[model samples]
Target: NGVMNLSIKDIQGEMLIVSQFTLQAKTAKGNRPSYIKAAKPDISVPLYEAFCKSMETHLEKEVKTGVFGADMQVALINDGPVTIWMDSKEKDY
Candidate 1:
C-alpha cells in the first residue's frame, strides 16, 4: 500500500515514512535482486522487528506497518504529502 492510502494527522508534527529493502533481497543469485516475492518468517521476523523499533526510537511514536502477505487489506484517507520520489545518493545537500 502506498503512503497515500495511510491516514496520518500531524496532531503533533509531521510523520516520516522510511523504506528499507535490506530485509528483502535475493542473495541466492549472483546479483542481489529483490526477493520480496519469497516470504519467509526466518528472514523477515528479525528485520521487521528491528525496523519498527528503530522508527519508534527516532520518531518517539508508534510506527505503523502493513501486514506481510498478498491478501493483506490496506486502506487510507487522502490527506497531504500526496507524492513520492527516489533518492539515489545520501548527499547531505
Candidate 2:
C-alpha cells in the first residue's frame, strides 16, 4: 500500500484509529441514515483490533484507537491543508 510506504516511525508521527460506522451508512432515502452494511459489534470489534495490531506491528510503535461503539468527541488540528483519499478497491491513488 503506497499510503503505508511512509516511515512514520522515522518521522515520529502518531496515528489514531476511529471506528467510523458512518462510512457504511446509507443515506439514499431521507434525512435519516441506515447502517445495514456496517458490521455488528460481534464482527467489527475483532476486525478493528486486528487492524490496530497490524498497524503497530508494521510501524514498530503503538497506535492509538478510539472506543469501538461510544459517543465521543474528537479534536484535530490540521498540520497542513492537504487531504488525500484512497480507495482499496480502486488502488489508483
Q: Give the whole-model CA lDDT for all candidates, comma-separated.
A: 0.59, 0.86
TM for candidate 1 is 0.43
Candidate 2 wrong stretches, greater than 4 Å: 1-7, 90-93
Clashes of each: 1, 0
Write the residue-wise lDDT of candidate 2 on 1-93 in tens digits. 564565667678888889988988899999999999999999999999999999999888899899999888988876557577656685543
Question: Could you give candidate 1's per-residue lDDT for residues 1-93 as a string of tens digits?
Answer: 564544334344444334344445677877758766755767766776787788677667777765544344445654565565667769886
Query: Against the true structure, what is each candidate's TM-score?
Result: 0.43, 0.81
User: Global lDDT for candidate 1?
Assistant: 0.59
Ten consecutive residues with minimal summed lDDT in candidate 1?
A: 7-16
List the pairs of residues colliding in candidate 2: none
Q: By how many angstroms RMSD does model 1 differ from the true structure?
A: 8.4
* Root-mean-square deviation of Cα positions for candidate 2 versus the true structure, in angstroms: 4.1
Positional deviation of residue 65's Cα in model 1 after best superposition, in angstroms: 3.0
